[model samples]
Target: MKKKVLFYLGILIAWFPAFSQTDNSVSAITEAREQLVRKNHEKSYVSHILTGKRYDLKYRGAVNSQFFRDIYPSYGTLVYDGVFFDHIEIQLDIYQEKVVVLLESKNNEQFVTIDNEKVSELTFNNYKFVHIRHDSIMSDGLYQHAFQGKHSDTFIKRTKLKKDKIENTKMIIEFVPLDKYYIKNDWGTFAITNKKSFLKAFQNSEAVVSIVKKNKTKFSKKKIENGLLKAVSLLDPLLIDN
Candidate 1:
């Protein structure tokens, strides 16, 4: 009787490893299926479409108005919460000063406004925009992304809707406003009031002063975007090092 019992015990021990291996395989397959379902759900649910808001102007790809860049509704990529989404259509709503994206919905396509705070950076058409803390006399600590160097020295082309009356007919005109450049200094941020005031602002930086004096022709008028950008480029390194 004792010999028979020992023989059965040996058989049970040999079967244990096979049973454990089979259970592990089953668990792995179940976990993989669950992950796939979650991924699909995120793809369908994590979308935003604009409705009932007058803030975003419809981007009709018309050349009637001035924009941040010439390209409208161009293919672009956006980064949010450190995740990247590509093959998306984007446009700059200058009137609203926000980056708008076109998203696909079951019924139709809709416009979605991206949250500035969640957006780390955006690349649209040929421009790269990054959020920065801007301080200026007109606005204070306003958070927005312009061209990369725009924070250091800002250049903007803005448009305002104006009414034009001719022969008792009132027509809306896309009025292009005067361009201006604002520079940030240790003292504070302010627009270039005049040639002499700008020179005084950068008076400490001899290199910038010399550049401005050399290209005095450009600063003859109120707006000198290219020259102003060049001056900021030269002084940026010094600002960073300090």
Candidate 2:
């Protein structure tokens, strides 16, 4: 009886640590999922940038009926022609109710139009900006600018990773060029050389995990401004042209 009692006690002690670890892992995964959902909601705001703009913009949400029917017909090729602007073709991918903006370029012999079949090949070239949660455990800029704007350039591009969960998860935000000159001149080149910016942005933008938990559901203008500034500052070294 004494030996059996000791053996059971040892098993209980071993199982306790395993149970605790499993609980911790589950909590971490749950928190990560919540952070991701918040990030997705925050990204929805990017659409506001195109609210009244004449540029062609598309939206795909997580609905199947009308959304799928509406997007499927345009799957082959989409051409946009504005009186003051040259023609442009946008290749789109509609899956899981998320629309990835594939490519945009001038309709010319030098540029190649994207086809629906080639979307997977072109997705890597596409850029997206998102807001993310971060933990305050470390200090570094969370964003970077790949291209420096010219003197007269009206817009600039920046990319950043907002850290969340002690660097375990990150929200990658890519500032898109709203201005025509910046879009045409700087976008392509920066996309190629600015890979480091992505890493650095994640490093710089650490915040308190508790703060993120408190503010996850609420959107604050101040937080967005601060994050944007930090991201742009990381790009200072690359901003020589501006």
Candidate 3:
């Protein structure tokens, strides 16, 4: 059965010719794009879709968010094994590191999970995330692209966890957010949690710390994002020779 599906997908994927502005060429390209979309749909669904087991929501828990942005499946795009697919219903499970999708078969519907290792890029919530693996400085995981500079780039690792606590004389599980920020340069990737850590990433820590204070940049967890972006822009020129 799997072989049959793979063979079916192979025949549908075809090469495109060089595009021209003529009316006939434009029409041909449109048809080809439509075909490509259809092929992508079939290839993505038929080959990689998995009937993933979902956690029971009946457990006593007051959850805030267990997903990337929305608790429900959001329309997005993903690059799976070098194939680009758009208009896919997906949810990024921050806790379990899973990608769940809603798949409909006839009159029935199910939330299915896809292989995460095959997925390199995912877009939703007006943001882009890339799966980083086999890197020298960074750990293997999904990281959200925050800012890019000539000397360095920044990424965010998003996560959540369920904590058991007592509230109103009842035991309840609450979801908590835990996010980590990283800065990667030619040397290595460093986790910058606060001003101290941010300054530590540079060779001249004392000078960098003074410059950061002079510019009044707060780089703690509360204001890490904007702070890091501003710091990168401020320091990129100084490290241009490095």
Candidate 4:
């Protein structure tokens, strides 16, 4: 199994040079090449290739519809396995919770899913993803990383997909946002559905609550994020220096 994976991974890397020949792919390729030349880190790098079963468009049971159909050819940047790759056109498969990148093939362009375990941080479609340990647990997974640099407190958004039935004849897919706001604080991860809950979760409750109160408007997801950023700025020094 390892040999098979490595073989395909090699093939994928071989095609990378073709991408570099184009002006658009030069920045990312040059960056990766420079890193290979300069960095002394010895971590093993893997370029995941979309194989027969893992390929989404050709998969059997997957819904023909996708969460990111509306947003395609969206160029972005990502750091995978500590190597910087930029100027990538990608689509977010929210249903499968995967980042799909467009790659060139002999026949045409193909869509390949990125292995999330290799992704350190990714940004596209105005959303950011970072590996995080949920609820202060040891296990790390990807979340729409919101606020960073607040050592003890980070804000993130988690998403999931829900399938809705359209009568008995058809179906529709929806990107159901599950608990869009969360505060990973010193205690643990806490969902922020309202102002009171937000105050109770963070040690800097006064600053957080004050921000909310000053808004004097109905609470919203955007407001929660803005408030968290402010509160995090206030709490960053204490959390980081400790």
Best by lDDT: 3
Give per-residue CA lDDT, model 4, range 40-144, as digits (tens).
Answer: 233344444433224455333334445444444588887876777788876666556677777777888777777787778878877777776444532466667
Which of the two, 3 or 4, has more lDDT? 3
CA lDDT, every prediction? Answer: 0.56, 0.30, 0.75, 0.62
* Pairs of colliding residues, candidate 1: none
Output the lDDT of residue 23, model 1.
75
TM-score for each predicted model, relative to the true structure: 0.57, 0.18, 0.69, 0.59
Between candidates 2 and 4, the lDDT winner: 4
Better of 3 and 4 by TM-score: 3
Q: Best by TM-score, which number?
A: 3
For TM-score, candidate 2 versus 4, the one ahead is 4
Q: How much is the lDDT of residue 5 in candidate 2?
A: 50
The digit string of per-residue lDDT tens for model 2 on 1-242 reads 45655565565556555555687865755565566556665665432211111323322332222222233322232212211111222222222212233333366222222222222211112322111124132112111122333411112223222222323474332222221111112222111113233223333233322233444422233343343334444444344342
**Mind sharing the TM-score for model 2?**
0.18
Task: Report lDDT (Cα) of residue 130, candidate 3.
Answer: 93
How badly does each model clash, as a count of residue pairs?
A: 0, 13, 0, 0
lDDT of 1 by residue, 85-119 (tens): 78788766554556677877788777777665666
Give the clash total for candidate 4.
Answer: 0
